[model samples]
Target: MHYRLICFDLDGTLVETAPEILDAVNDTLEQFDLPGVEQSQVERWIGHGTHELLVQALAYASGVEVQAVRAMPRLFAIGQAFDDHYARRCGTRGRLYPSVRETLYELREHGVRLAVVTNKESRYTQRVLSQHGLNTCFDRVVSGDTLPAKKPDPRGIEDCMRAFAVPPGRTLFVGDSSIDAATARRAGVAVWLLPYGYNMGQPIEACAPDRTIPSLASITDTASSSSSS
Candidate 1:
């Protein structure tokens, strides 16, 4: 492996979680007597964590603005309800992307340190990983609330590097959105984006990552590692 450490973004990059996320969002909206949001809307609302996504859904369903939804007197209760709904729906509709396990195993076999830095909160992150039998595949897991700031802040990536004593030059961040690309850039590390993951309905190439490989398997030596970090 050309890189010593590789960090992943959980939602779209590893797990095809939009379906479950949409289900949870709709479940919460229905419980609140508000209209449900579509999966397309939810996909665009992702990458910022569930709280923001919930707020967006509420705003849309209730015919209110995002700020108005946030200012609702029952906002706290609404968040709680969404959390409950999402917790139950964690892995119900999500699955690991193609070759995800194989690529991860190959990377580990080559002695590459793996980590997950996601905007997902800790509880949900744990459940999702565990549900997919991926809990032990990573060396570190950084959720949205794990540190002082989340992605695009560089703290999580920096924290991982510091813990592993790996330099930025030998680190790679793989994600499915511009947020991930920005996070890697802020941390001064190379980034690779996937074409199949959520990107707010935008093109992956628009994120300008170091590489836009077709899938996780594309990075393995046997699969076509034509480029290196």
Candidate 2:
């Protein structure tokens, strides 16, 4: 195979975490006597890091315009509260996406290095992965809190490349968001996107990944065909 490493996005790509995330966000909102967000809105709010999500959610819930810099500190506190709640209740409603385990196993069998690059907090990400028995499947895991900068900055991808000792041309980044596409582009690696994952309510196809798959398992066939060509 031409690809030596495959990096995956955590939240929407490998796991369906919407239910738990929405629940946690709602719980935190309730504590503040704020109106809860709609499920669809929460879905769209994801993909960015936790702080960004919280800021947007708070702005939406309080009817405060997002441009208010004065409210940022309070929103950051609410975001931290949401993160705490999520950590306590993480994975309670989340599960591996269909075919995720099978695909990871197959890729591991083929000796392809695998890593997770996500905007989730490192400790929480570790807890969720361990609880779901996915910790062993990945050779390395990079969380949003793992570095000073998150996706779209190329730092996380650069870290992944360093961990795997793989060059950009030989690495494949699989994700479900424009953030991932941006990260791949910045890192100079090939990118594949999954249609079923979150893309901040935008059509993932518009991100123009090198390839798009309906599911993670489909990458096997796509990779095989790409190698042959």
Candidate 3:
């Protein structure tokens, strides 16, 4: 196989987490007497993590002016509250994407090393993985809070490569956003994208993934062959 390591983005790629995340966000907003965000808008605000999501959600909810929202000292309080709420609610309503488990098992059985690199807090990422019985599939997992930098920064990808002792040319990143593409570009790894994932309200095809597949299972054949080569 041409690739020695495979890394995945968590949120939309492997799991359908929109419902849970949206519920948690809306719950927090309601608690603060703030208006809730629409599901479509919430999809666009995701990928950056909870704090950024809340900031954007609040800005949208308030309609008070983006600059004004940034100036609000209470924004931090809201963010913290949202974090707590999400901690309790995340994964509750989410499920692994179709065929994700089967694909992961196939890749693992084929001797392909796997890892997860997500812009989610480590605790939350672990919680979701554990809930879905996916924690054991990956050789390593890197979360946004695990290091000083996150996706699109390339540091997380570099860390994954170092952890696996895999060269950049032999590593492949599977993700759902432009951030993943940017990280792959910076880290010198090949990237494949899933068409159904969230890409900040933009079309994921525009991110220019090397290959776009409809489901995780679609990569099983490729992964198996690549690992043997």
Candidate 4:
């Protein structure tokens, strides 16, 4: 394939983590006597990291604006509670997307370096990757907290490209959201978005990613095309 390095987004991209994320959110909400949110809402709120999702949930439950949730004097305590709940719920119900493991192996076998750049916080990202047995597949992992800024800023993708010594033309970002598409665009790399992952309730096609892929399995075609050429 033309690409030397591939960076992935977590949550909706690599893992279907909304089920557990919903569980964690509701768990935290119940502790504070707040109404629980639905899985659909949680899925829609994903891609921004756990804290942001929790803020959205609290906002919805309390009929307060997201900014109000963020400004709540006890927001820190509430965030801490959410952290504990999410940590416990991290890997319990999450699963890798179709063809993810096989594709990761295929790419690795062909000398394609892999990395994960996720808006998910470091703790949740590590737990999910380890639970899915994907820890060793990546040459590097850059979580939301790893850098000063997260997705749409492109720092994570750029950092991975620099670490791999690969230029934008040789790098590809695979993800499931507009955030990922924007990040890759800003970094001058190609991005392929999956249709099934979270795109903030919008169609992935609307994001106008370089390619709107059906699944991770299609990535293997790159190797075949390279060989045939």
Candidate 5:
């Protein structure tokens, strides 16, 4: 299918941010005198957004349910600590997925507009993009805080479509989770999933993306002809 606009998810699709995020969550838990979780556990909590990750982390650390953690008087302060730690360490440990840079350049060369639609807040999104020298690759970036609601709502995808003047059929959302698939479905766009991203402990195939690709390099060939339809 030919597509003019290509939207990507941040955490798992484009970059592996689990390490830094996990470390920050652990750091916050330690600050509250709670036990830290395993990295594998934190990986399962990724792709939802920092707030959700922190909530889950707090719940896991304190051996309480998420609701209990939410009701705690120190939840706000703990959340702030997580936020601060993450802000300082966001891009320090993560690296772009293989072939991402090359594929993005190839897509841009083919005149396909690129944008990021992430559940991450804009504050850290910009930092990650700039840190990895990816700030120039995208034509637009829509963060979790940019809209009233996040993925599965389609608002961000719709906003990207409007910003790029692309129709649903001519747009594709590339991500690593069901949230991205749902977002594309609700926005009437095509979705392609990556096999190696965080899908909340489930296989990416369970997300039912239109296609599952091995790597970003594979998209270069498809994206070249994608504008012909």
Candidate 6:
């Protein structure tokens, strides 16, 4: 096999999780009697994980700086409230990006180990995967809470490499944001960015990924080219 493993970012790469995330954030805001945030606002806040998302959203809704919100005595309680709301809302309305399911099967058939590396908490990540019938697609999953550090740190990707016994040279990270690109770079692995994901409202090309594809349907092309090279 040219590449032994293909590690994927969950939100914006394999799945359109913003809807569910938006719902949870808005619901939590409503619970606290704060104004709900818009989907576009939540999209920009994603890729950073749930805690950061909530911090930014709460700040936006309350017209305060993020640090101010963080210093609030109720921040922890609000985070817990978000956890509860997000748990109930996970995968309730999100969807797999086009060609994701088929592409995973194709890659797996060629003996490539697949894994999910996301900033989402493990509990919600697992729940979302199962809800989308994607639990079996990946051989392993590494979430934000899986280790002390998350994306933009290389531990998650490195962990996946170790689990699959694949070296950085033989691994590819597929994702949709600068966070993903930075993670892959820190791990010394190649990365491919998808054009359609969130990416904090920036163009995926701005991340300078090794390659950009419109969808996962073209992943086999990357695999084939790598094998030939």
Report RMSD for candidate 1: 1.6
Note each model's CA RMSD in angstroms.
1.6, 1.7, 1.8, 1.3, 1.6, 1.1
Off by over 4 Å in 6: none
lDDT for predicted candidate 6 compared with the true structure: 0.92
After aligning candidate 3 to the native by TM-score, how far in Å is the CA of 129 from where it should be? 0.9
lDDT tens digits by residue: candidate 5, 160-220: 9998799998899999998899999999998999988888889888888888989888886
Error of model 3, residue 60, in angstroms: 0.6
In model 3, the runs with Cα more than 4 Å from the true position are 224-229
Query: Candidate 1 — which residues are off by over 4 angstroms?
Result: 222-229
Best by lDDT: 6
Over 4 Å off, model 5: 225-229
TM-score of 5: 0.95
Mind giving the per-residue lDDT tens digits that candidate 6 earns over 1-229?
5888999999989989899999999999999999998889889999888889999999999999989999999999999999999889987889999999999999999999999999988988898899999999999999999999999999999999998799999999999999999999999999999988888989888899999988999999877887897
* Candidate 4 Cα lDDT to native: 0.91
lDDT value, candidate 1, whole model:
0.91
Tens-digit lDDT string for candidate 4 (31-140): 99999999999989998888888889999999999998899998899889988998898889989999999999999998999999998899889999999999999999
Question: How close to the true structure is residue 21 of candidate 5, measured as C-alpha lDDT?
Answer: 83
Model 2 regions more than 4 Å off: 67-77
Clashing residue pair totals per candidate (backbone < 3 A):
0, 0, 4, 0, 1, 0
Better of 2 and 4 by TM-score: 4
lDDT of 2 by residue, 46-129 (tens): 887766777777788888887773356576677678878998778799888888999999999889999999998787788879
Better of 3 and 4 by lDDT: 4
| Per-model TM-score on C-alpha atoms | 0.96, 0.93, 0.93, 0.96, 0.95, 0.97
Error of 1 at 40 (Å): 0.7
**What's the lDDT for candidate 5?**
0.87
